[model samples]
Target: MDVRRIGVVGLGAMGAGIAQVAIEAGFDVVGREVSDELGTAATERIGHFLTRKVEKGRLAQDARDAALGRLRTTTDVSELVDCDLVVEAIVEELQAKRALFVELERFCRRDTVLATNTSALSVTEIAAATASPERVVGMHFFNPAPLMPLVEVVRGELSSDDAVATALDVVDRLGKVAVPCHDTPGFVVNRVLIPLLNDCVRVLDEARVSPEALDAAMTNGAGWPMGPCTLLDLVGIDVHVHASEALYEKLRETRMAPPPRLVAMRNAGLLGRKSGRGFHGY
Candidate 1:
């Protein structure tokens, strides 16, 4: 389970953090994006994130330099041919991810582990599209990947025990807690957390309480770090919508369905912090 070169196929927030964590864990990372500009920006953002860590005395300057030195950026997915592991953190689109895995199979070696950072989607479906289904697994890192300690090592229907072991080894190398799970919708954390957040939104919609008051009750009364609405805004309304849909479809439970206000908010483009508005202002 010696991981050397790692490839991250997506430059979004989760991808950037995963790349940072990998680089810091002594793995040479190649970050691939759809465009050159995005690749460069993702690289710069990683540098900035590491710089902040150094400023906070959490990471040494020499270590930061070494980590940065290990990072490579490219717009060509084929450049990841030599990578030992490639993790896809792209948008939660089944067709898009399936297409990418098929393409990756053509370029990468037979033994290369193909993992998806999908929070909610069928790992079995994703693996079905790849030539090496046994080697395809889910390495779901939580939001703010560098900061979160939990990593869900999901075993799809066709994912081999070796693949799960390899993913767990990588999780240990990254200094995160690895929780092995089947290809269950929402896995473990989001399966419970998303519904709670949705319930919070329902509470607001039902006139049970105001968003501010509800948030305060959770934080102050329940001793939560942040209110549900605040966390929802940070998680992005669109992300919640996708996760809710996945859960509802799998469990066939109304409680897991996305609240009306959330769907309306997303339809109106009020996608929380990313869109400068949600339950709260950006």
Candidate 2:
């Protein structure tokens, strides 16, 4: 199906980024927020990012204005009824995501593609919440979705081939690469990346090297664009913890387990960049 109108069900970083990307791709975007405050904040956040791009000479002002014109925000999920595709980018909890899917099924047509932006949760479980499980799939966009080029097109057990093809088409329309993967904990990137970050945390917890030194080694010696510690902070420590716990629960692997220091940091409310402090202070 041709996806011209897109619905996004959260105003958090991921949702906002996905909305902006859709708007920039010339698709009308309707975003649902929990409150008026978040609605306003999401709009302003997207506007600010566009403004930055304009300032950096990466985006034209006219194009930014045009994209902004295609964007709309609301607090009602019913407003998304006209959307050809609805992507849920809310919290990581399975119950919350399932509940949202149930609510979405009420308003959305059975043919309208329903997708979740879940990083590590079960797409099969989320799809089970709706009657037309074949129409449900996982469209996992990375952090800062507009900037990230990779979109994981995850297929649930019952997801239809048409649903997956529609999702891949939408990703291509947004000028992003689509990687197909089965529904699994952490999908692809997180499944491999988080364990490396966990090892870095363990090294820090053991007091073997300073965070700066460890990061420097990875950046200078390994030639990584950003060290694992910095990437962890950028991705948010709490997010990493949750993804790790979810992986460990399903896989029962030591590498997927959240390290002791990660648990301590999350308990202390040091949730990385969003919280202003984590492995290193923002």
TM-score of each: 0.97, 0.97
lDDT by residue (tens digit), candidate 1, 89-144? 99899999999999999998888999999998999999999778999999999889
- Residue 144, model 1, lDDT: 92
Question: Candidate 2, overall lDDT?
Answer: 0.93
Clashing pairs in 2: none
| Runs in model 1 lying further than 4 Å from the true structure | none
As for candidate 1, its clashing pairs are none
Candidate 2 local lDDT, residue 69: 92
lDDT of 2 by residue, 85-198 (tens): 999999999999999999999998778999999999999999998899999999999988989999999999999999999999999999999999999888999899988889
